[model samples]
Target: MMTDLVLIEQFDSRTAAEVARSILEANDIPVTFEADDAGEMIPHLAPVRLMVGSADEAEAREILSEAMKSTDEAGEEGVDGEPTA
Candidate 1:
């Protein structure tokens, strides 16, 4: 595994970030998150940083974009019912 981690996305809530992480992992991409809450909180008050290997940055972004778009199409936004546009 490459140690060069790169921040690919920042989500307002832990649920959003976890969803993104699941999307990435489902595609066989390794990811890491940086947050103060240790993935226990459900608030959108703080941002969560989603990261992947530098070599996987482009792929990770594309996957996340598609995931978010699909969620938009499904009439859901940001995992907590917040508007995404």
Candidate 2:
């Protein structure tokens, strides 16, 4: 049986999208990456789309949200190559 895939996120870099895909997959959420960059000959030529089954969208988003939220928090705390006060 085939399931409907929904675009849940997009990233300018494939590496970021790969990280998102890894997170979703690790959570047991089905996901795929969509991009048209001449078969990755030029990955930055287009944004990478992170897709999940329509049924999995919410869970996938929540997982990603939590992950990104932590990243944002770290940045706010000055963890990106900077010392935190």
Candidate 3:
């Protein structure tokens, strides 16, 4: 399908992709999942991808950015110097 906008987010795991998808849906944007065929043998292919249309590109990027920022912050140590990781 031809899209006016397409953004790619690489997730460390499939669950992360799903979470991202849900976030987009919750915000009223349409999302489509793309993945290498399970039956295919492409080792270099990503297992899952969350796709947002061109119209929602900006909002999608914001949502993804926020998710990544929160994830990064969660990995940092608190003011007391206790590492969350």
Q: How much lDDT does candidate 2 score?
A: 0.86
Best by lDDT: 2
Per-prediction TM-score to the true structure, in the order listed:
0.75, 0.84, 0.69
> Over the stretch 1-85, how does candidate 1's per-residue lDDT look in tens digits?
8699998988887778888999899999998988876445545546799999999999999988888788667785666778667
- Please report how far candidate 2 places residue 83 from its true position, in Å: 5.9
Clashes of 1: 0
Over 13-84, each residue of candidate 2 has an lDDT whose tens digit, in order, gives 888998998888899887888898888899788899989889988888899999999888777666466767
Worst lDDT 10-window in candidate 3: 37-46
lDDT of 3 by residue, 5-47 (tens): 4855656456677799888889988888676745345524666
In model 3, the Cα lDDT at residue 13 comes to 54
Off by over 4 Å in 1: 38-45, 76-85
Q: List the residue pairs that clash in candidate 1.
A: none
Q: How well does candidate 3 match the true structure in TM-score terms?
A: 0.69
